[model samples]
Target chain A: MALAKRIIPCLDVDQGRVVKGVNFVGIRDAGDPVEIARRYNDAGADEITFLDITASHEQRDTTYRTVEQIASEVFIPLTVGGGVRAVSDIRTLLNAGADKVSINTAAIFNPELVKEAAERFGSQCIVVAMDVKDLGDGSGRYELFTHGGRKETGLEAVAWARKMAEFGAGEILLTSMDRDGTKDGYDLGITRAISDAVDIPVIASGGVGTLDHLVDGFSEGAADAVLAASIFHFGTYTVGEAKDHLARAGIHVRR
Target chain B: MSKTVAVIDYGMGNLHSVESALRKAGADRVVVTDMPDAILSADRVVFPGVGAIRDCISEFKRLGCDETLRAVIEAGTPVLGICVGMQSLMTRSEENGGVACLDWLQGPVTRFPQDHRDTAGAKLKVPHMGWNRVRQISAHPMWNGIDDNAYFYFVHSFFVPADQCDSVVATFEYGLEGASAVAQGNVFATQFHPEKSHDNGVKLLSNFLDWDGSC
Candidate 1:
């Protein structure tokens, strides 16, 4: 017996509202996080992940109160990420009703943070967030990017993921910076690489243009989960339609 | 008439969405109630959810619907359990360290296997996601308006492994073979969310609605 696959929709919150963009630019107001979560809950999203893409650098905030509003209203489980830098932040998110927290730049800056989060909140509560990109030198090797995909670190993405798993990070949220908002499809090569390197769950994010992209992300990428935007935010593809397409494609999903 | 499908809202589910989906699926009557008789009297029953496995099994017991459900099925009534509700039909489940279930089938609910890779070099991914095809096997009532290899939606971390291969009415291949739908007489369940699955979801429900027991 093994865990079931998950279909998760991501909500990017800035200040106190829901917004989305490609390459993290030209952002558009999507809607209220609470409203967006409610619709996805109704549409059959298994879980919801909130990415505070601005949390790392912005100081215009005191706490993640928006997540509380959305989590309180939604019945499904939730994962909160972005600028999550400390054990207290993890506790705050959990106390605020998040099922997990995704750590990105923080984990890269101090790899030990993953171990500490896992030790404190249990491994299942800590998700190692990895943003990756190709050097474009033609070797097809990927390097880790951090700070909401704005900074590139020379660390090999796959090696860092393996390290996260060893430190007890229960899951991995792998986003391909090159594919962010391209809607072309997921970066299967990056997703497959990390998925193969780790034993925990891998959530493939970015480049979800159509239903087929999601399909390829799950099978070809070997992702335990698929995370998307644009389509979900712009309403090009509803969660239910995505699930049905996956189900018909021979993927196991919650119906 | 509201059609009145009594959805068992046992603290363990996302009953709201299932209810909304039913409404969107042409279900005129949808009520989220756990009163045993309401569940019994409804034209159909839907058990919706997303929560701790332990709390749910206990909630069903507290509401005393365990035997009521057994009676409904004995009377040949139609019922459906989404996610954990679907998992509930199996013998038992292993979660929160360890917990037991209705034993309706005969085994503990377990994680999806990574065996697909070992057997065929198939891709192995947990919490398998996205749109995948479902291959129908036996002629179950849930297949009413749907065809073979039709698609549906899914999201979960665990599944039901049947006591009998015959228990599986439909299956989808991932790294290993995963049971997408299971049937034991009138009791039916799926690993995907029909409410979120669009037309395929509606068709499966409609099939359950039109079942005449001829197959």
Candidate 2:
């Protein structure tokens, strides 16, 4: 049987609470991170990603607790990221029950960290999260962003994705800054590019407003999975509804 | 009394999630322990693992769980191995520069070709993540209530070949046919993570719990 396309609901957590924002700004509290995670788990989400957006060290500890609580309640695979700087950090989250740890800024700072974590924890548990923004200079190329999309790395998105895979990243959480929260759809161009370039699974994140967007993610983008936040968080579409739509569209999804 | 399920912890394995899944699967007393006695004394044992085979073998040996596992298997106690747990059951693995395994199953673990491709000529990813259907090859207790081609979650780069065809109970297509589940006498193992597989996973775990180690 063909492997089913995954539907992942990403929870942007701040201080232990799940939050949502537009264009990575103007954040607003949605609900308790654990509650939302449990809801998604029961609603048939293939997986859940908890992106800890908190900046302070103390609040980061809170994110760890949030991850622990969510992992306890959610049975599906959980991916936690945001401020994952070291192998010890990954170990802490994994010990707390996270199935995979998403590495972003730290991965760029030290690509070896990806290899180290992958070697130590198995590449299956390391997810390299790439935040890509359109160059907008008519180059039609995308560059990587760090610090929650606040800074640009000047590294090409597709190349960086391939590098991460070479460095032993099991999966790539590719997020499009241009399409994030716009609800238009994923940046299919870059998504398909990276998906084609890497031999590891690619999870398309950002800009999923409707079920069709999810279908597009799998079809046009060739993504192995699709991740969204607001659409799932605010009831714009339930996880079951999205899965049903994908199933109807002839995309295999776990029922 | 409900069976006491002991999940072997050699400082590896996703023990927490496995323990939680066992509980959900109706295991009343699930113990995550590295203590060899705790493992041997349990009614059933779950050998779950993740990460590198080099570390897995070292830890398995260092904790002396290797000898304990051998004893449990020799005693015909029902044991379930997941992922690396399943891989380590084989004689050896090409991973970690050719590490030796438990030799419970007469086969070698090999890595999926770096350029592995599906029948459609499409490139397939390694560390085959996500859910895929498992086709049962033979009737076994662990197959109880699970659909013939039910989907289960998987995450691994290397796979154990069904060299000992008699032990293979199920197979899944991922560029090539690899053993998804293997069974022989009182031992059962799966490459997929039943704990992470939701309904199908829970059902499989529950079946393992109810299994009497009889073929």
Candidate 3:
């Protein structure tokens, strides 16, 4: 019996190094991806996700060597995202030994990229991440942002998510544009809405401030996993401490 | 004499961290060697490594450690395997054209496809890496002092598909049922690496050291 909920730490990479920012701005050195990855690996973090925010937009490829470098150093699952536009792109990363590949803007433009990857790699290997922004109206309209949340496309977030799952997306990464760097909390409405709409695993991203946010994403939003930055970077909440709290709250989390 | 835990090293695994970890966890005796009498004499045995299952089995044949391990476990000494070492405990593995395994655990071993929708790995990633939590089940001695749903370090693309539900002490959901940890009497194995999992890892091995197999 596999557990349903998980907590993940996201490391945004640019130019083969780890970097983090608020609202995707003011990128700061988070340290070597390998070094930081080892720290999290030692901390008992459930999973590690590396997003190559600079790869595709800069006409580069996934960090094949770096991915392998990290893989060799740490003994845990590694999920890589960004600039994954084609099947061969996925192949390069996986062959380099990444456990999973995540797609964002590419799936938005080509939809079939998700289906093709899922059909070939199997749905579990395919993750479609949606950087979504709430349009601020009772109309409850949401737009999808791509290219590291730089480009915005006019697609209703929920419906597009359904299409992605239908196309064989094993999991969905839902990040909020409005709350990304605010450290306010997750966009619970957005998280809950999409989670309710899809049967596949949903990982909540953006605006995580404290340990409680991790718990809320799993319980209130019903997200299978939650991702955040400042809280983890600033030494606010450790994964062990977070899991302990989640357990106390009665949410199923790995201690 | 202090209880000894033998981690068989056949030049086929990444056992440095595992040995250091077991040592750090207070296992008074941790030896890495292919000497069968020493392995069989120890109170516990360990198999550790990283590579294709086929290559692992081939190395086992070359060193003849396989026969010694089977004898030791059949003699009822507790034995454990880690990662590729863990996968080698299975009946078969589909890696670099597949290979027969130690048959310690039933069924085939391969990557865990994210969604049940894909199994052959044409789209999903093969080598699943990173930390994922385990959902603990049952009253196996492996659960001694460990809390339920503890996070463990996992780095593999292929996994042992679940068929003998009872053998699985725990499982993980990456998109499907990952036989996260399988224990059958004196033989135990897990997909995650406790050696690399820090304090939690140390605690897990400690539990193994202190296990009485009563509950």
Candidate 4:
């Protein structure tokens, strides 16, 4: 059997609670992070990702406690992202039992943080999450955006991905701001471009409305993993159904 | 009688996942420690590592866990090594310009060949970072209740060469065959992360806790 393509359910956590956004806006409460994570684990989620959207410093400890509690019972790979700027942040999440930490805005500003975090923690745990929006110009270019896809950095998406991989990023969490919450599908062009460019694993995030989108991700997009939020969170589909669909479509997934 | 399993922590990488998994697997007392006295006296011992092999070896040296580990194994205590923990049990590794290992197992940890392709001609990814079917090659206590060719979560770039390892009990293919699990006397090691592998993994950890370090 080959390496199974991963199915990661993304949990947008705010102060220990799980939230899901519609098209990156219209926030809706899902449930407790620990409870949702356990359900996903029992339903056969390959991995669980927690995006800590805590807006304050004092409540930051809530993310850690959430991670600690889930890790104590979930028994699956846990990835914590959002608001990770420093190496110490990565360390704290890891110490709280996060298997990997995703860095987005920080990597664009101080690329050295990617290098240093990878060097200190190993590339396996340093995931550089890239939020990209297609320029939509006739030039066929894509620009990287940070701050939840509001501000554009003008940095080329594919090049930045290669640079992050060079800086020793274990994986790239490529989220298409344009397709995100649009429920269309992944940006296959950019996904394939980045996946082809980096030898490391690429996890395609955003714009997954159905299981077929996941198949296209691996087959057409060439992504090593697929991350989704609302579809799995709102009970549109279970992690098991997603895997079953992937398996039936000839994409090897954990059964 | 009560059982105490010492999870050797050398400040390498995350051990809480491993520690909590052991507890969930029914270990009466799972102590994560670096003290030789604590490790050697335990009913079972677990050696876990992550990141660069050089750093792992250096930390072992810094903490003087190298000699302590060797002594614990010699005393016939059941030992379980995970990830870099498994690689560090080898004689040497080709990571970080090559690092010497504990040599408890007779082999070298090497990186997957660059540009390796499977039958589909697709270039296999490094770090093998997902669930892959592990084919059990030999019967061992760890395989109890686990199906042959069961999937486990793995995330690593280097692995023990399947051909050179006589003690390989399980293997998985990623363009080229690599050792998934190996056992020698009281020492059992796995390249995958059992703690993160869900139910199958929990079962394996449970079996490890019940293992008497025997075949």
Candidate 5:
């Protein structure tokens, strides 16, 4: 049997509660991160990505606690990101029960961290998260952004993705700023480009308003996994429903 | 007395999650320890590991775990190895510039070809992360309640190509056929992480807890 395409529900946590926003703005409380994660686990989510949006030093402890709680209850693989800045941060999260840790801003500042983390803790546990935005110059190029999509790095998204994979990133969490929170769909053009450029799994994040959008992410974008927050957060559809839709749409998903 | 399950901790892998899953699977006493005596005396030993093979072997030897583990196997204790734990049981691994392993199994661990492609000609990713189905090749006590071709979570770039096909209990296809699960006497190992595999994983772990080390 072939590897099943994954449907991941992202929990964007602020302080301690789960929050959802559009285009990376206008945040609203969804529920407790741990509780929401448990719901997803029971509903047969392939995996769960927990992003601590606030990611402040003060929130670090709280985030760890939340991850520990969720890990104890949820049996599926859990990936935690957002405040991870160094190897120590990665160690703490992994020790706290995270199966993988996603690195974004720190990875851009020091790509060596990607190599170091992957070398120390097998590449399977290191995820390089790329927050990307289209340049809009009609060049069909996307630029990398940092600070939660507030700062633009001018680095080409596809090139950075290739570099990350070369440096031993096992997976790429590609979040499109333009499509994020827009609920239109994934930036299929860039998603497909990065997925094709890297030899590792690429998780398409930041859009996904409908089940059809998810099918498009896998079918057109060629993403190995599709991640959505608001869609699963606000009850638009349960994870089971999404899996059923994907399965019926001819996309193999774990039921 | 309740059975004592020792999860050999050579300072690698996701020990906590594995221990928790073992507990949830009905192991009344799950001890995560590096102490050789604890592991040797336990009713069953679970050798779980992650990270580079070189580091894992160095630590395994540094802690004198190799000798103790060998002794446990010789004693006919039921042993289960996960991921790197499974890989280390092979004769050698091509990871980390070629590291020698425990040689408990007759195979060499090799990395998946970087340019591996599916039948559709699509480039398959390394690490082979996420869920894939395992086809049962030989029935054992561990396969008790689990369905054939059941899906399990996997996260690895290296796999063991069994030299003896009869030793392989199950196999999975990913560009090429490889042993996803192998068994011989009291020893069992899997390339997949049953702890993180949700229901199927729990069921397998529970089966291991109940296994009597009889082929």
Candidate 6:
């Protein structure tokens, strides 16, 4: 049998509570990170990713505590993204029981962090998360964005993924800012582009409105894994249903 | 009777996850320690690692954990190694320009060939991340409750070639067949991370805790 494609439930955690906003607005508390993670684990999620959306520096330790609590009970791989900046930050997160740390803003500002973090922590735990916005410029190009897709970096998404791979990133978390919260679907173009450009696995994120979107990610986007927030969080679809759908679609998934 | 499982900590990578998993699997007490005395005195030993082999081996030597591990194994204590910890049990590794290992497993760890291609002629990714099905090749206590073709979480670039080893208890396919788990006497090791491998992983950890280190 081949490696089964992963279906990861993304929890946008703010101040230790799970939250999901529409287009980065209208944020509402979903539940506690630990409780929500346990539910997802029971639902047979392949992995759990917690994007620490906590903004205050004083309250940042809450995320670590939340991660530690979940890791104690959740047996699946836990990836914490959103504010990973330094190598020490990665260390603290891993020590707190996070299986992997996703770096987005830091990688663009200081590319060396990726190299050094991978060298120190191993590439398996270093995931380079990229927030991309389709230019719609008819040039069929995607640009990288930072600050939760508020600011643009003008760098080509495909080339950046390749560079991150060369710099020792084990995986890429590619998100589409355009389709995010739109219930449209993943921007398969950029997802496939990044997936084809890098030999490392790419986790397609954002705009997963239905279970079929997950299958499209693996088949059309060539993603090794797919990530969604609201669909699974709001009880519209359980992770089990997603896996069954993918399996029926001829995609191998852990059931 | 109460049991203590010591997860060797040499500042290599995260040991808390393994410690928690072991505790959840029924270990009375789990200690994540770099101290040799505590490790040797524990009822069970877990050697887990991440990152490069060069650094893992160096830390093992610096902390004298290697020597301690040898003594623990000689005393017939059940030992479990995960990921790089499994690689370090080999004779040598091609990682970091060829480094000598503990030589307990009798094989060399080699990187997945850069040119290794899938059926589509596309190169398979290194670090073979995510869940892959593991096929049991031989009977072992570790597979007590685990299925024949159970899926396990694997993440690594280097692996022990299955053909070079005779103690292989489980195997998995990436671009090539590789040893997923091996058992010899009191020591059982796996390239996959059981602590991160969901319920099946919990079953394996529970089995290891109950294992008497026999075939």
Measured against the true structure, the TM-scores of the candidates, in listed sequence, are 0.63, 0.95, 0.62, 0.97, 0.96, 0.97
Weakest 10 consecutive residues, lDDT, candidate 1 chain A?
A: A21-30
lDDT tens readout by residue for model 4, B1-215: 57999999899878999999998988899999999999989999999999998999899989999999989888888999999999999989999888888888999888888776688788676768989999999999999999999999999999998999898999998988899999999999999999988888899999988888867
Task: Please give the distance, in angstroms, between residue B165's alpha carbon in candidate 6 and its true position after superposition.
Answer: 1.5
Q: What's model 5's lDDT at A98?
A: 95
All DockQ scores:
0.06, 0.66, 0.11, 0.80, 0.72, 0.79
Which window of 10 residues has the lowest lDDT sum in candidate 6 chain B?
B115-124
What DockQ number belongs to candidate 6?
0.79
What is the Cα-based lDDT of residue A247 in candidate 2? 91
Candidate 5 reaches a DockQ of 0.72
Better of 1 and 4 by TM-score: 4
What are the iRMS values of all candidates? 7.8, 1.4, 8.1, 1.0, 1.2, 1.2
Q: Which ten residues in a row have the lowest lDDT in candidate 1 chain B?
A: B114-123
**lDDT tens digits, residues A1-255, model 6?**
378899998888889877663222222434667877887888889899999888886688998899999999999999999888888899999999999999999999999999999999899999999999988889998999987788999999999999999999999999999988888899999999888888899999989898888999999999999998888877788788888899999999988
Instruction: Name the best candidate (by DockQ).
Output: 4
Q: Which candidate, 5 or 6, would have the higher lDDT against the true structure?
A: 6
Off by over 4 Å in 6: A21-30, B120-123
The positional error of residue A243 in candidate 6, measured at the CA in angstroms, is: 0.9
| Residue-wise C-alpha lDDT for candidate 3, range A182-207, written one tens digit per residue | 88889999999998787677889999
Error of 3 at B67 (Å): 18
Per-residue accuracy of model 6 over B1-215 as CA lDDT, tens digit each: 78899999998988888988888899999999989899999999999989988999999999999999999999999999999999999899999999999999898899988856777675577779889999999988789878898899999999999998887889998878999998899999999999998888989999988988777
Candidate 5 falls in which docking quality class?
medium
